[model samples]
Target: MTATAGAPAPSSTGQGGGPADDAGKESADTGPISAISPADSPVSPVSPASPTAARPLPPALPQTPTPSPEGSRPSRNAPVRLRALDGLRLLAALMVAAYHYGGRGGEISQAWGSSPREQFPTASTYFAYGCLGVQIFFVISGFVICMSGWGRPLRSFFASRVSRLYPAYWAAILIVTAVFALPWVAFKSVSPSDTLVNLTMLQQPIGVDRVLGVCWTLWAELRFYALFALFVVLPGANRQRVILFCAVWTLGAALADAANQPFLELVLMPQYAPYFIGGMGLYLIHRYGHDALAWGIVGLSFLIGQHYAVAELWHAPNPSFFSYRSTLGIVAIVAFGYLAVALIALGKFHWANWRWLTLAGALTYPFYLVHEHLGWVVVEVLHQKLNIPSYGTFALTILLMLFLAWLLYRFVEQRLTPVIKRSLTAVRVR
Candidate 1:
């Protein structure tokens, strides 16, 4: 999801209960809270059961509504916020940072006729694993956006999203530009026009890396948001209907990849679409109040796909076949996407919470934006000036980056968010 444009404002609490309470009541009012049985739900792609079906079906159990603590709200501190997600983001960021720094050492070592891996194993592994973080971020974005927008009006949903993401993002680009252009630093390659394009979030449209280099993910995310908005705008956009949309998108993406069609790749990449749908699906299950068993199934599906399944498929020798890659990857992506949704659905369940990690997760966007550049500078300076070992330097650089991220979150992002919100509000009124 996009970094919210405003300060970390708490979601508005509903009277006598919060959004959770309202959601719970709404779920009850809607109907039975059992898992959306493949046979019963129109959203499920399975064919209708025959009257002469071999075995008798078991009676559906009444879903026990998970009890939420009083006065709970979904925010940075929400108990349902998965700590694993934070850990995942941390892992991804470090991977990217290591990849960049490690590659630099690799370049130097090649010139010196030494094995780069021996000198910079940390960097090598990080480089290898860095792109995984981007995948994880895509999944997380899909899940969070889906959960946050579930049952909310499309207009308010879009507004809140724009409000939350743009402010900190714009501020970050400006800060980065200023730093890069400093007289002492003199890190100039980007022009003012380029900076403006990056700020407008259109860097990807013209086929150039944004000012930050890593901002390509933002383009993907924007596309997901636009698609999601379109899905909601279509007639009969309900939980079941959206699930079908996700299934179609997931399968279609796999098909496109198999056909080696570039235009289709833009739409069919599960990373581009399924994760968001999975997130939406999870939110529907949660919003409808499915039992723990259902949540378990979703989680299991996500883990199996993310860890064991996708790795095996992607690591295949000469595995350039689009169908193979797309099929496995899309399943994993959609699975994890749904798992994130499942977690959100059971937002009343408090098991996933970890305060510090949640805070780190909240800082992910800024950390992502700043870590590479700042961490690169730190690693270089330490290596060149102080002659630090690669691993030691890597560790130290990450710590320093994290510290700087904390300061940015506390001082700049935290402060400017509210001001941006107010300005947006005033503009809307006008």
Candidate 2:
């Protein structure tokens, strides 16, 4: 495996588990790494692992994406290469970790309210804003999925998506459940019904919550996959059609929000669709050159995305979590926009090719999967009993979480994804 491709076993976030040797300023493979084909091998269009072979760009992304002249846009039998978005992935994951760490201070404070409480005041105050990372993740997901899905069959896409999501997710859920299920530190009890529900990663739609709270986002991610899969079937689709389809989606969301239609909002993914849409806009620019349609999508996404922040202002118990000094109405806008700009830089700048950043990004999905509740439990237990300052506990917690994420990446997601892919890819979608 190249040191920075393949990730997440299939959920939350995944760090790259493929080779890092080829993460150049101009990425040449359609993938960071693939199980069916190695990066250096002669391009094989028939390989099940060719994630960017000739098919159709999803209709959801209507306008034909601009491609770099030499290496973008594979022909019917051509090879496709994609720049690793590992750096972006890692940045987004860390943001969520920071958000959890910053916000969960209240949990510790509640547990030991009477004691000496001299802890990270600034860390507590500002890091809470890291919650914007989840939105960043959604945008990254949209971009990555589009990159991965180009010129591929729907079944192949499903196999690729499923293989990447499930293994690491299952491992994480089992580990965390075991941790929380212990009697001495029992924060939650897991039952068979919950276990079964979580295994499908559809617990939210079924009215059952996930064993790990973060698994909730998987529902939205899966929904996006379903919608975008339609576009993959329409290889002949044009930009105007894709733009119209997305515009209609946004309108549906706006109408849902205006009428407070909870079911529509929940099913349509209204809260974060614009970010996902915005990410697709970046994908077009990143793969192809700038076009009016792609830029228009980004612009309209920014405008329509406002509905989320505006709605949260009225509904969220903590509105500051959604704001950042008002330079942008929502912190997600700044995060998504920053990342979009960064995508362009990756195309144009050599310095963006740092190897370690890609490593961090590859491990992101696994880290995000494992960090949340377990980290909170550790901080609460360590600081409350041992009298460690919250800062010390927070630092230690981050270290521990990062270490665990590395383990998941190195041992589980990175190692196992290929085996699963080889087997799944061999099935031939009969």
Candidate 3:
């Protein structure tokens, strides 16, 4: 049920595998003010999952300088980077990691030799809710994708995404596959054909199995990019057009849900659309300054998002069998996620502008990619074999995951992104 493969049913539930599970699974910009700066300009590279991008703002919309921990804001026309937002990405990644490491004991119970709840009764209860972190990531994607993709032709937008998403992802797929190949590792190996298909990140649509459980979200992200490129970027995205896109997407998703049309719901993403829509609304406010219209968009998204959040909890596999999730708690967690981003959009967390936070953000996508199954295997070796305490195993696994993330980013993503970008651009010219 969870995004992970071979994981126990109730113990693992968050992102779904393939199109059906990913359709509305938890997982977001604004407006027309002189083609606001694209987040993907040639400044510091931002992760595809990260919300902050650096580009000079359009001369039309100048921002007044404000005091903050990072010092006074740069002139409005200067490139904008929300370092705090980057840090938030790491937090979201960790929340999901916590869910797997501390919250669930299902498939992992084989290694733990007992239930995780028994091992960390107090912690499991809190970490169980971390699954909601997927929604937070989705919301942030909406904001960053909209910000980064603004003012670009469809080709340029696609190129930026390819460069950002594929570098780390490719590295992750090979790395995880190699680990799974080890004779000692218990996880099953993905077939060679499936591995090749996964490289395209289209395995879900074509009904091929995912190499990494967490990769299910990538399908959602890819759909979002395609839709945005076609509807928003191709026609020229601005405040009015984007707002219209949001409204239309919201309505279309609702209709799809009502009609019980699986294909429509898959495309429209009724469950997940609200968060993405709301994020775009927040970005509009961030870029163009707050207005009733943007606020209304966000409000509508929250209403719709809340409905799906609770519904996911209720409809979860055998809700009565091992139900530890509360509907109200789910709602509250989702609201907290929205509030955190809203504060960032409003520039209320200016104090979070630490430089190292950007590094933390950069690690998020790679961290999320490598964490789940790999971490589970590591936990098995550490606790089951080494006889380490549960908490100690958790701590060591997180540190190792972070190190792997850094390696993926520094050695793989950093080296490969520009290469991929150039390759794509070269092909385009021909």
Best by lDDT: 3
Candidate 1 residue 227 C-alpha distance from true site, Å: 0.7
Name the regions of candidate 2 deviating beyond 4 angstroms: 1-84, 104-118, 233-244, 259-263, 313-349, 428-430
Every candidate's lDDT: 0.43, 0.51, 0.65
| Candidate 1, superposed: residue stretches over 4 Å from native | 1-84, 103-118, 182-188, 233-237, 258-264, 267-271, 285-349, 425-430
Tell how far residue 88 is off in model 2, in angstroms.
2.7
**What is the lDDT, from 0 to 100, of the residue 291 in candidate 2?**
64
Superior candidate under TM-score, 2 versus 3: 3
Which 10 successive residues of model 1 have the least lDDT summed? 13-22
Q: Rank the candidates by lDDT, best first.
A: 3, 2, 1
lDDT score for candidate 3 against the true structure? 0.65
Could you estimate the TM-score for every candidate? Answer: 0.64, 0.74, 0.84
What is candidate 2's lDDT per residue for 1-430, written digit by digit as tens?
0010111122211211111111111111111111111111111121112333332322222223333333434223233232234554555556556655553333334433432123544554455445455555565555555555555566556566665666667887788778766777635545767767678767767765456655655666676667777754345223444456567777887788678877877756777678667766655655445566777877777666555544442233453332222434354544554455345323433234444654555455666676766775787677777888766877788788888867876787667766675676675555
- Per-residue CA lDDT of candidate 3, range 323-395, in tens? 3777788888889878887887776765565667666666667777778778878988999899999999989
Q: Give the TM-score of candidate 2.
A: 0.74
